[model samples]
Target: MANPTGSSLLVIERLLRDRDGIWRQIIEERDLKQLTVQMLTSSALSLALYGAVLGASNGPLQAVSSFVKLPLLFLATLAICLPTLYLFNLVFGAKLSVLQALTLIMVTITVTAVLTLAFAPISLFFLITAQSYPFFKLLNVAILVLTALVGLRFLTAGMTALNDHQLKVASRPPALPPAVELPADKPAAAKENGAVLTAPAPVKRLSDIGGRPGELPPGERPASMTLLYIWILLFGFVGTQLAWTLRPFFGSPDKPFQLFRSIGGTFYADILQTIGRLIGG
Candidate 1:
């Protein structure tokens, strides 16, 4: 939140720290529900953004039609967004209102537009205007990335600072320093072989998990759907990537093709096997 313009970067930094338990209280109670929502939202945003980047690579200028006057387009957008955002913020207090969020977004886009408009004069130094299109586009992306990165770094630093404070507080020594922790200088006994033999690592603080420690024992509610979804995503993502990488060489008899596919196939198989073993295959 230190820099609103780099919202993605800031959010990412928070997510990283949250993964490290910074905002676990705000999220863990719902059993990672917030984390799932955030992941989905971030994925949606990234898909939209990268899609735009891919589209702009071909011809950004030609992509816009005659009726789509850039300046008027921006004006109309801001005019619609700012009012909506402000009203929503006033009413529900959620940040997503276009007036609230989009005002800054519009301004950012306008800056890019102004930079583009100004680039024409700079283009005179070069003969081929068409060839310079990529350069101009690259410049815009660079500007956006720099601003986003700065905001993100600030947010990340903030999250880290808060997390350290929480961890320290949660871990402070009790007045007597709990003789129970020493447990006769040895672990409690274990009845079953292959079971973890020691006392559990202080079960990650209750406040950190947004509930009392041991609040929900095994027989309580099931874990979460997000864990399953994450696994599914990784399974498909890794499988597809592997298939794509080896496709050309999969059936080839040429010098390195077979060797390459064999090695790649072995790598993937080993990965899947390791995963299976870890999950009690």
Candidate 2:
């Protein structure tokens, strides 16, 4: 089999062992196709895993819908959160290019997908043994939530690492002192008097003069956990909405198979009802 490219396999491996290095590549890498391929591969994996889990209760039909809905839910959530993240990062002075931001988000998606895939066998076991729909739904939901938490943790760590790297780059020694210019009127031998002619001291920019120690340079800042939390919340909101929109992944065994359930209530409401059933039992 052909090896997967950097965006998929290589980046994921790097994320596991060298998060900072992978993030640096995300910022510096010029090829966007690698990132795209990574996202697509990860999405495909997520679809398969979700299908397997949903297959437990809904059978083959719902498993097929899992092929569609799971990817849609994740991609949609990424699309919804991308702009907010880019803008917030810009405002905070970490101006990421659109591609860089997208790549970072894709990394998070890939991480989540990998984690979900890792749990697929357990889900399949549950499918065979547990006949309870509410239990299946809750278990799958818990799995997704755990995966999402891990993915978001990676995202935040990556952002922090990249921001710190940027700060270091920004703080590098000021450009070589401007070349010294000599006046044409002065004789080249004027220095024969044993006087030393030296370049005038370089003028420091306002940023260099005013920046506090350990603080980011002007118009530059590091990411904050506050922004990361907001992003996580936004992702969850979008994910829940997308899941509600693309319903019936776990159709009742008694009910007929369907791709889209009639819109009746919010995802949270359904979860609450499921919890009620689980507890009442």
lDDT score for candidate 2 against the true structure: 0.75
Which segments of candidate 1 are over 4 A away from where they belong?
A: 1-31, 57-131, 170-281
Clashing pairs in 2: none
lDDT of 2 by residue, 1-281 (tens): 55334555455665577766567677676555675676668656766666657754766877777777777778877878889988887887766777877877787888888788788888778877887778888998899899988988878877787777777776666677765566778744346368755666766753666885456666767766698788789878988888888887778888878878788889999899999999999
Give all candidate RMSDs, comma-separated.
20.4, 4.3
* Model 1 poorest 10 in a row by lDDT: 248-257
Q: Which parts of model 2 have CA positions greater than 4 angstroms off?
A: 1-11, 30-32, 176-198, 205-209
Give all TM-scores, in the order shown. Answer: 0.27, 0.85
Q: What is the lDDT of residue 32 in candidate 2?
A: 55
Over the stretch 125-152, how does candidate 1's per-residue lDDT look in tens digits? 3313444433433343344345434433
Best model per TM-score: 2
